[model samples]
Target: MEENQLNPDVDYTDMLSICSQALDFYQQHGITELIHAFNIANILGTNQFYAEAAFFYKVAFNMHSKSAGQFPLAHFLLMARLVALLKGNFPIKEDEMNQLKGLCIPLYNFVEGWKRYKENGDALSAIRLMGNCFEEFHTGEEADTIYLTIMMDLFNPNPEICIKDRTFGAADFNVIPNNLFMYWDQNPPAEILQNFEYHKGLTHFNLKIFDKAEAIEWLYQNYGVEARQIFLSARHPAEAADFLRVHVINYYGGWWLDADIKIQSIDKFCSIIPSSYEHVFLLTHNNVVHNDFFGSVPNSPILNDCMLSLYRNSYLHTGLFIAYKTGPGIFGRALNRTFYRSLRGETKKPSVVLLNDRKFWSVIADFETPYKDSTPHWQAS
Candidate 1:
């Protein structure tokens, strides 16, 4: 029960133990009730076992939908079903699809649009259907974010392939330049510097390291006043770096790794990327596209979308959190827009690839410096 309570420090092993306990408790008590099924689903969802969570949610929904109640518990359960499926990237089954159609027309339409897009790489119908869901469904920001993520996933050209198919040798290279970039606000500590040099030696790529002043000067000279102003307005050094990295990569297409990243092996890293990809990113454990390290070709539409999002989020929500304002949240939104445009034939389908942590860790890792604890985290601030 203690494990079921919220604790950010809970590790994978702890999650497994909690799941085992919950399952055993259910089996021992012969609990086959609707709420019990939903409770198990919640446990699984909390542990990041989304597919299993989705199955149990489905079971709960079937039970709840059959009963009539004054409360909207059935509606809540149905929404959970949608969230679980989207997060897990699992397909909707026929019975579930039929139930969705009967309960909430707007959600059903959006899910059906997702289904169509997933089945065939067309986005026009999906886009059209998606237009009306927000006005009709009226879910809050959190649900909207999930819906947007689902749209992105449905339109992804290669949803499952991360790095395995990208085993191109030294002869082939991406349109993105061989240059590597990293930044620190001021004098980087010894450990970070060591990480910088290590990655440089590993890749043998032309490395461009920047301090705050240098970053500002580069932005001013290359992108003019608007970019320089946005960079200047950043609340944290991390926020400033976040804005600058996108501009740098979008202007001179190449790889951008955080100063703290250390590549494990150059050969393994190089072997995983296909030369044909215009852009590449890694999906974090929570399924959001990681912004800490990624690559792009110059003038990539997706990166451009990110830049636009930064500018808009900066001017509109000046006090917004860093992640949504200039980090992975904006990046994921950009992916959604680019994928939609690609589906509608409005632009060239982005040649983007997304890898998971398994392949990503096989290549590189976050090298924490001694100053990590002393540094001000956004969450702490």
Candidate 2:
């Protein structure tokens, strides 16, 4: 008889039993499967089968060391460290503590690599881990400051030692000066000064000192191309709204042009597009009710009327926005005030008041503006 002719009826209970047996087998034998067990233990503490989970993690760690060498050590170390920390306040198991201690160098090295590469996300992650470890070790603020300073040096834009090959090129034209650069020449931190010789060897681009118009013209003339200009002006809504208007016009010399925009072409879009309008174009798919993307719009009677209404009602959102600027005018002050009031918690109904207004705003609301999300990006903090 053919095997197909002898087909048996399916049994749900047997199938479930088989699945349970397989899961049990996996739990008993599979080292890779322990990550899930560790995660579960992390979420649900030792009182709820976490001891078993920790045991599984330990087994997985040992298996990883035996099979993959030190490749998986960082992950296992982090997991074990978290478990040890959580189960603490008393003396931990000596072997477990030693294992956690062993992870410190590798973790620190990983963080150092991130800082050197200016990987903002990784740097932040490393900082978080360092902070946890510091707390566990009761490390003093002085040690923390040293660690932070070291990390900052790894990512500093203006190091004293500028290697010729490492100098800023045309591609790095948009790199903005950070607090590190501003303080480097004045009260050079010891960490930065140590690498000053290396920074000096690298070429530098001084955007603030260079003639921007000439630079733009030169790039166009020599390279047969035009570069987009982006002016990042960040401030408290009360102060920055006024400053952004002057900055944009001064940088671009009051030229308006329509250009193709892509999702990734934010700087390019902002440069070619005119800011003198009620609705400034954005290089994002997200909608905005106000032009907060450019910081502030030109002042106008319409905006003045809206400002008057908001002031009379004592309403604000303290949200920054891109504004519509047709010519030299200060029409968006009310919107700025609105945002300032909202931020100060002076406005009772922030979201409804600022975002619901349709007369003075556009599709983009003040809250809808896309601010920089990266750690190294511009911010007052």
Candidate 3:
């Protein structure tokens, strides 16, 4: 497993196959106490096979929760909670919830109390509990870093949607969002805009290319003072982009694309939108959800849920602030939760259309990450 992480040449498919076999062996032989499932989840997650990895993480986490102290365990269960949040397994079974509630025993209650805070809309107590989680599982600098990151996000969410339910619905346009919205912090070379202009969808009004100022204003109005300060003071403007990305889709409706996502692919489909039943257009690469290129009409319930789930996870899984609090991990978790809930008869309409990567991500652009330290990706995609 260390080799896989160190070596750049590892084949993810083969790694997953090996891990799956190990899981089978562990299950059949009843080597419960000795079993560790993080390796499997790690491999799958790295390769973008998040949904499957989430399923495994959930089972392993539950098993670990029920085990005696002899079971394989990490000093901090941050990763476990992260993948679980990404899985979006909400409204968990009564027994599962109980196990989670009791895990942070003696120090203080964990999930159970967090759930109460969420229900009551009490941010202060919730953040306090999250800080306690950091102290409980980590120490020294690691604990300090974890606590600070969660507190920053909690203090300044940089809310995405400034205006809700502005205009457009299925009746107004084939898709509720009437235009294609892609984000770029700096102005793109003329060519990108050219592609956008030429390939504009017939049903839409205009292509709105958002930059840092627009994103900042929208989020500031929606999320308020602390969020505005964070966006302005962020090391890189892109760190605040995901905050804006969620708000754009939630408020205006339409697609969001990484600058690297080719314009032609989305433009080609401009003539057509997903059927009325489909609420979102997402794609999975290597069996994991990849939203490098994705779309939603307007005011999608799952997008709101995804935003909410992120805060819910802040206290429990904020160790990897960039990945868990603000990356596709939570987005995938929210999306997975939406689909799972729908399967259980919680939602009526069909949600998410998984697309083909070969079609959308062809000719992958060579682009450098705008921000290296935080990897605050998709803040404005």
lDDT of 3 by residue, 1-381 (tens): 121112223334443454565445434543233144555655555555655565446545544554456444531243444434434444435564445445545223444435545467565565545434542432222323323323323332331112223344545233645556666666655554554554464334456767777877877888777556655654344445555677777777776766544454433444233444335444343333444556776777767876675444444454444544555555655554454355446785344454444534442333443444444443333
Off by over 4 Å in 2: 1-53, 66-71, 78-84, 87-91, 103-381
Question: For model 1, where is the 10-residue window of minimal lDDT?
Answer: 1-10
Over 1-381, each residue of candidate 2 has an lDDT whose tens digit, in order, gives 011111224222332233444345444643234454344334333333334434445544544533335544545434453353334322235555455456665444433433433435444445434543322221121222233333333232221211223243355112212111111113333443434433234333121211234434433453333121211122223222223233332233221111110112323223333322332222222122223233223333234434343322222322322122111112233333333344346763221111122222222222221222422322342
The Cα local distance difference test for each model comes to 0.71, 0.31, 0.49
User: Candidate 3's error at 306, in angstroms?
Assistant: 1.3
On a 0 to 100 scale, what is the lDDT of residue 376 in model 3? 43
Candidate 1 TM-score, true structure as reference: 0.65
Count of residue pairs whose backbone atoms collide, per candidate: 0, 48, 8
Q: Tens digit of lDDT per residue, candidate 1, span 212-315?
A: 99999999999899889989988888899889999999988988988877766766766765556788887765567778888898888889888887888888
What shift in Å separates residue 23 of candidate 2 from its native position after superposition? 9.2
Per-prediction TM-score: 0.65, 0.22, 0.49
Q: What is the alpha-carbon lDDT for the whole of candidate 3?
A: 0.49
